[model samples]
Target: MFKKVLVANRGEIACRIMKSCQQLNVRTVAVYSTADKDAKFVKMADEAYCVGPAKAQESYLNREGILMAAVISHADAVHPGYGFLAEDALFARMCSQCGLTWLGPQADLISLMGDKAAARKFAASRGIAIIPGTFVLNDPDATERAALKIGFPLLIKASQGGGGKGIRIVTSPDDLNSQLKIAKQETSSAFGSTSIYLERVLKHARHIEVQIIGDQNGRILVLGDRDCTMQVRRQKIIEESPATFITDAQRRELIVTVHRLLDGVNYQGLGTVEFLFSDDRFYFLEMNTRLQVEHGVTETTTGLDIVMLQLQLASNESRLSRQIPSCDGVAIECRINLTAPTNNNQLSTFSFPEGIRVDTGYQSGDNVPSYYDALLVKVIVNGKNRLEAVTLMQKALANIKIDGVSTNLHDLQKILASSWYKKGVFAVETLDMRLEKHESFTG
Candidate 1:
């Protein structure tokens, strides 16, 4: 076990990782920007260091600053919590070269799975069901050819895309030319890579992802599945464990498929395999080579500490013969974002609800700046069943009150009370349609 670890990220996830490290008797070093001088994670950590200015380029995303912090702190390991440099292969390699343990997958796996096009091809070669897609297209003519082969309503997605960025949907040939150009430009700007591919967009598909943990010993355990279909603006707002739509048999099949895919690749550490469930079949979307933002649901349902497991795996500990953890109940998480209706600005105050688990990295009097992600807190609930979980989430959202900043709390409450969500009949576009219809209704 590592004696001290530096967290190379910010916000709730950084605080969450610090708490887990504390529980495991590990000292934590938090790296923060000048903007987050008094952030929750910094206060929680045993030691905190100011990396750079508020801009991400000079701060959170600055790899050299983070590495220097870890080195100066003499930390044994560095945990990149979810975003920033979490899945950066170069960061992973740097950690290895610096003789510090990277509490995630090896650089090789990160490099391999980070590329969507390469990942799709690897999955196909390993017999994993992959969505119909084309390889990376450098020329617009090749993109047109691939789009025609994949048919209309295809998604022009970035080869190295994540977080729903660098993706565009083309409904027909007329929209293809312009949409492809825009997608390529966005991909280049966001990821610094113009490499893009095509994939058949599954209309009304349920976004289901399997959480799996692997160790250096090649042991892989599928924790379960999460239903992330309740999304608005291509961002998942609510996520639940043990999808309401998939049957027990189907769930088992999905687990087996994930195991097969991992076994073929000899995958390691905590990773998420996302899939598009449509027409009673699962098509691989892409693999996230790091911990997911919605991993709290899985922890609530299974009572497992994923961060501890990741640390152990990074230390080259054996994990073979360990049985899959059992999930006692259903868990749901609502991402409370500090976003306004018309304009995006910093939040001045925040008020939360009681009798619910509110995992947050911000507090009252803290500024929810517009320079970073709008996520303020993650409210998680667990119940004996899905309905009970839904009701608990609704109550939690109702009690949450944040002044001086507009949030999706009211919208989330409406979603929980809707017929589609009540019956668990939701797709990716479900929230958008609901919001469009209820644009005037605040509650």
Candidate 2:
């Protein structure tokens, strides 16, 4: 029942959040960087403010400027649409101190789950199966010892951030020290923390995650699951609901375990618990404290507005006791990313299939800014079965066209045509391998 809510992020997510706010009759305030002054989300908001310059550090992540905008706009709450300051515990606290409701989890829970290393340990302690990993690394010797203990083929990862950055894979000791140094520097630069950890790598695992929501009264609801195995450079490109690969028993176990973990902690709002599935076992990966980039697929399958649920949780009355909806169909989402050639871009003909749902940050003729993430749109499709969903997605992608900017539309079509993908045999590294093979053959 907020009169006005300010979205503290950019791109498709911001626009998506505004749609939900509009449906709920809540006025929206949009804070944008100079690079995004004329973006679609800004135009859609009831009030807009320029936070700062193009760089995220000075703009989207500017806590003071965002707080000032919220205060000046008289926003009753702030909904950080999934990145930048979404998981910043201190920023959440600052919003609370300024008498604005924070739309996600409480500050303490955010701080606890934000630390990757600590989260892994907490999951293990709570009886959630976790990949064999080490605590924070102190020195090269410590890294060497952890490597030997966990065996070769391990991952060196930043302990404070996600989004697939600050990660390095090493198969032997000779590469450990060099990779560790690089990871530390990258981690420090990206997350402002030098903490690192080690984990035994699952060579071929299906990346599965469960969608979970909790309320102030400690009720936890599992909104089904998604398979995010189609990734390039450790970033997910395609996400699908109902997983389609796991058995009924495995799905039941995953839901029960995730529910148990959330029940132990006083978790609130929307979150995702990721896992690596291999050899009929699931290993906890990490928890995302905010809404995921692929949440559209879940929404398609469940027919529920996750952002609306988050708002209801943040409301003072907390009247979110509605029963969870039954998931009916299979859903798929494709992320449309702007290639390097489209730095200064224009969309001449932006159109999608009639039956498909496309979430985008720009309209036709809008300049695609290079200041933020490369993702320009998400095309989500739903069907009665997986095969139908895949076919619908292929048809939808083929029909869609956005001129004056290069994208991965053709790449996605090729993937859908491949036998390996059709047989559901792809993994996290499948896209990179396929692209490499294609390049080598062409060369």
Candidate 3:
């Protein structure tokens, strides 16, 4: 096992990863930016290093600085807790070349799956159905031709990036060229790659994702699926395990299909197979080659520590049991962000009710930095059933208090009380509909 692991990220994920490391009796090294010098994660680490300035390019995303920190800290492995360079194939290669165990998938697999266009082809080749889409297009003529074939109401997405960046929705052909231009520019800026692909957008699609972990020996473990349909601007805000509406047969098929696809690629470590579900059909979106933001809920449902499994797999020291464990209960998670209500820099009081896991990187009196992601904490609850989980979440959210900083607590409370949300029939557009109608449910 790795004696020390360097977490090459920040915020809630960084802290979450460190906790797993602690459970495994592994020391943790944290890398921070100038803006996070006094962050809670830094203080929690056995060793902490300031990589660079507040800007992500100079700090959290600074590959060289992170590498140097690992070297200085003598960490045997590096766990990139999603985002930043977690899915960057080159960085994974660099870590392996430096004799450090690279958590998550290998470099080649990361490269193959990171390209949204190529991943679609790969998925289709493995018998996983993909959405009606076109491969990476370079020029306006090619894009126009593809758009004509795909019809209006299509999404132009960046081939090399995720996290809802570098994507544009064009409702009609008259807006195609302009939207394509903007997507390319944003893609270039965000991922440093201008590759873009187009996919037919389904109205009222629910974002469903399957959590998968594999080993170097080709063993794949399906940790179950999550319904991340609740979103604002394509960013998931609420997620739950064992997707609510899908039938048992459909759930089994989804898991089996994803397992086959991952095995075909000889994928290693943690990954997520994301899909858009509508009309009782699953359309492959893309695979994320690292720990997901909502992994906490899955962990709660499965009773597994994903970060620990990543370490063991990367070390090639342990193999997962062949028997798949049954999911015990329903789990729900809400992302508490610094945005939405307000951005008060200071966090006066931060507390949550019992029977919930609060994964956070902030503490009372800590100044929330605008230089990074707005995520303040992930509130996770587990229960005997969906309704039970939802009820527990309500109690947790209602009693929780985080003053001095603006958070999405109120919005989340409204969502929990919404009628559509309670029925388990809500789609991605449900929240938008509530907002448009200015409806708020107190129940």
Candidate 4:
């Protein structure tokens, strides 16, 4: 076990990692930017270091600064909580060279899975079912040809980075070029990698992902599945575990597929294999090489501390191989944003409601800046079943309050109370329709 671990990120995830470190008796070192000088994670850690200015390029994303902090703090391992340098293969390699454990996958695994184009080829080679798509194109003519081959209503996605930042859906041929340009620009700006690929977009598909944890000894455990179908503009708003959409048979098949893929690649540490389920069939999407933002839902349902698992796995320990964690109950998570309802302006003051698992890294006096993600907190609830879990989450969201920021509280309340969502007959466009109806009614 590592004596000290350095968390190379900020906000809620950093705080989340710190909690696990505390329980494991591992000292934590938090690296923060000047903007986060008084952040909650910094206060919670045994020691803190200022990395750089508020801009992510000079701060949270600065590899040298973070490595220096880890060295100065004498941390034996670095746990990149998600986003930022979490999926950066170069950072993982640097940690290897520095003799510090990267509390995630090996650098080669990161490099292979991080690239959407490469991942598609790899999955296909291993006989994993993947959505029909084209290779990465740099020329405009080639891109148009590829788009036509994939047919209409396809998606253009970035080869690097997730979180739905650089994805565009084209309904027809006329819209392909414009969407491609926008996707490329966004991908380059967000991930510094403009490499893009195409995929056949399935209408009315449920976004299902299987969580897996592996150790150095090549033992892998599939925790369970999550249904992240409730999304707004490609961003997940609500996530639930043991995906209500899949049956026992389908769940078993999906788990087998995931296990085969992980075993084929000899994948290590914690990762997620995402799939788009339509017509009762699962099509492989890209894999996330690090912990997901919505991982709380799975943890609540499975009663597992994923952070500790990552730490143990990184240290080449395989204690969890003897028994797999079972799903005890249903769990749901609602991501509370820091934007206002009117202008979607960022908030400065914040407060959370009681009677729920409120995992947040921001305090009342902290400023919800536009420089980072808008997520303020993740509200998670566990129940004996799906309906009870939904009910508990509804009440939790209603009781929650945040001052000085506009959130989707009302929107979330409406979603939870809607007939479509209640009956689990919702698609990706469900939230769009709800928001449109709300706007029309308000107008």
Candidate 5:
């Protein structure tokens, strides 16, 4: 166990990580910006430091400042709670060189799997099914020829972009060139990379991901599978465990396939291998090499402490005999975020329902800084089965009360009540296509 750990993030995830560390008696250090000087996570930390100003590039994403905070606080390890340098290979390597443990997989693995282009090619070479896609586009004529073969209604994607930034859905050949340019610009501005690729859209695909963890002692655990089909613009809005959409045999096949996929990579720590499932088959998507926002859903279903697992693995604890805890029930998570700007950014009266798990970064009277993500709350519910979970979620959602900001609560309730969502008939594009008419989505 680590004596002290520095959390390299802010808000809900930062708070969440600290809680787990405290449970293990590990002292936690929080690094914040001036904007978050009075934030909840900062107050909860045993020690806190201000990294920089409110801007993420200067604050949360400041690798040097965060490292300095860890050194000054005498933290034995650093935990990057999901975003903001969590997957940055250079940052992870730097931590190791400084003799501080990095609570993640090896930096080389992160680099190899983080790039979408290289990951896709790697999956294909492993005999894993991949969506029809091209490598990094170069010469214009060759790129056009490749696009024509893959057909229109394809996606122009930034090879290094995530969180739905550098992506364009080209519906026809005429729009391909313009969409490509836009995607390139977005990716370059966001990721410092203009490298892009193309993939044919599988019309009615579902977003499915498998959670895996490996230990230093050559042990592995397949937590379970999750269905993230309910998404708005490629960002997952709802996530549930034990993906009910797939049949029993298909579920077994999925587990076996993913297990084999990570068989000999000498992987350690947590990871998620995503895929696009359609027409009784699945194609490999990208892998998230860090803890995800929706990880609690899987945790609830399996009754396992994923964060604690990460800590134990990082310390090379060989006695961890846990192996794939049986999935006990169906669990669903609704991420409530602000859809539009509001008058007062501070929470006037933020409250959540009882008898359910509500993980949040803000309490009543906490001011939400405008600099970071607008995700205010994560409502997670677990029940004996999917229907029971859905029923419990609806009631829990109804009990939530937020008086300050404009959020997606109404939309989330509508989604839970929708017949398509209830019946698990909704595909990846189903929510986006439905909301395209009425709701304006923000990235």
Candidate 6:
């Protein structure tokens, strides 16, 4: 096991990773920016280093600054919880070159799968079913030809994008050029790439994902399947284990498909294979090469500490079999976030209810910064079944309270009690998709 680990990110995930390290008796090194010098996660670390100033480019995302901190701290390994440089293959290589263990898959896999276009091609080459999409195109003639082939009602997505950025939905050729121009600008500014790809968009698709890992034993571990259909602006806000609407056969197939896709890769960390399920078929999206923000839902349902498992697997400490742990119950997680920039960012009345696990980085009297992700906490609950879990989630949301900042409390409640939610038939667009207009998904 690693003696010391340096967390390369900040906010709630930093706290989440540090807590897990402490549980393993591994010392933690926290690298913080000037803006987060006094954050809750900073105080939780055994040693803290100020990387740079407030801006992310100068601090959190500064590759050189983070590497320097790890070397100076004499840490054996670097754990990028999520976001920021978590999936950057170059940064992972830098850690290895510096003689620091990177708690993730090898850099080659990250580089190959990080590019959406390359991932699609790789999946197709492996005999996996991928969504009908074209390669990254920047030429005018090639772009027009690909659009005609893929047909209308498609999405123009960034080749190197995640977290729902640099995407444009188009339904007609007339709107293609306009949306394409917009997507390129966004992608260039956000990802330093001007390339974009087109793929067919399934309407009212359920966002189902399988947690998988290519263990050190050259075997695959399928943790479970999760439904992240409840989302806004392509960002998932609610996730649940044992997807409510899929059949038993479909679930089994999903697990097998991902396992087969990852088999013989010699990978040694956690990853998620995402799919858009509709029309009784699954369309591959992209693979996430790092820990997901919603990993808590699977942890609560499966009785496994994923972070611990990640550490163990990375350090060759856990030699596992192919069997997955049976689900303890139905688990649900709701992400609580600051709805918008509040007049007063300082938290005043911060409190959560009992009977649920709340993972957070803030306590009462903490200042909520607008520079980073707005996520405040992840409220997770598990019950004997789906009905019980839903009831518990509703109660937990109602009992929670906060002040001096606005949150999506009302929005979460509205979605939780909607008729679509009770029926377990909600889709990725159900939150914003007007039920009265979309007769197919209406109560």
Runs of candidate 6 exceeding 4 Å displacement: 435-443
- TM-score against native, each model: 0.95, 0.96, 0.95, 0.93, 0.96, 0.96
- Regions of model 4 farther than 4 Å from truth: 138-142, 185-194, 340-350, 436-443
Residue 398 CA error for candidate 4 (Å)? 1.8
* RMSD after CA superposition, every candidate: 2.2, 2.0, 1.8, 2.6, 2.3, 2.1
lDDT by residue (tens digit), candidate 1, 1-443:
88999999998999999988998899999999987887889999999999999898899889899999999999999889887899899999998899898878789889888998898888888788888888788887887888898998888889989668678889999999888778878888888998988889887899999999888765788887899998877899999997878988888889888877888456777899999999999998889988889999999988888888787676755454467688878999999887663343445657776677788888877776566788888999998999999898888888777777777777778778876687787788877776778753222
Output the TM-score of candidate 4: 0.93
Tens-place lDDT per residue, model 6, 35-60, is 88889899999999999998888999
- Poorest stretch of ten by lDDT in candidate 3: 434-443
Among the numbered candidates, top TM-score falls to 5
Q: lDDT (0-100) at residue 170 of candidate 2?
A: 90
Full-model lDDT, candidate 4: 0.84
Q: Superposing every Cα of model 1 onto the true structure, what RMSD results?
A: 2.2
Mind giving the per-residue lDDT tens digits that candidate 3 earns over 18-88?
99899889999999999899988999999999999999989988898999999999999999988889988
- Write model 5 residue lDDT over 1-443, tens digit each, in one string: 89999999999999999999999999999999998998999999999999999999999999999999999999999998888999999999999988999888889888988888898888888888989989889888888999999998998888897555578899999987888788878888888999999899997999999988878744567788999988887888899998988898988888777876777887778888899998989899888888889999999988888999889778865445565678888999999997776545878879987888888889999888888888999999999999999999999999999877889998888888877677778788887777777643322
Instruction: State, as a TM-score between 0 and 1, how close model 5 is to the true structure.
Output: 0.96
Task: Give the per-residue lDDT of model 4 (tens digit) for 1-443.
Answer: 88999999899999999999999899999998987887899999999999999899899989999999998999999989888899989999998899899888889989888888888888888788888887677888888888898898898989875566678889999998888888888988877888998888887888999999877766788988999998988889999998978899999899889877888566777899999898888888889988889898888888888888888777755376655578888899988875543433434556556767888988776666567888888999999998998898888877776777777777788778776677889877767766777642121
Worst 10 residues of 4 by lDDT: 340-349
In lDDT terms, how accurate is model 1?
A: 0.85
Query: Tens digit of lDDT per residue, candidate 2, span 1-443?
Result: 89999999988999999998999899999999998988999999999999999999999999999999999999999998787999999999999999998888889888878898988888888898998889788877777887998988899999986667678889898888898888888888878899999999887889999988878765778887999999988989899997999998999999888976788577778899999998889999888888889998999999988888778776754565555567888999999898775567888878887988899988998988877788989999999999889889989989998888899887888777666777788778777776777742111
* Model 5 per-residue lDDT at 244: 83
- State each candidate's clash count: 0, 0, 1, 2, 0, 0
Residue pairs that clash (backbone atoms under 3 angstroms), model 6: none
> lDDT of all predictions, in order shown?
0.85, 0.87, 0.87, 0.84, 0.87, 0.87
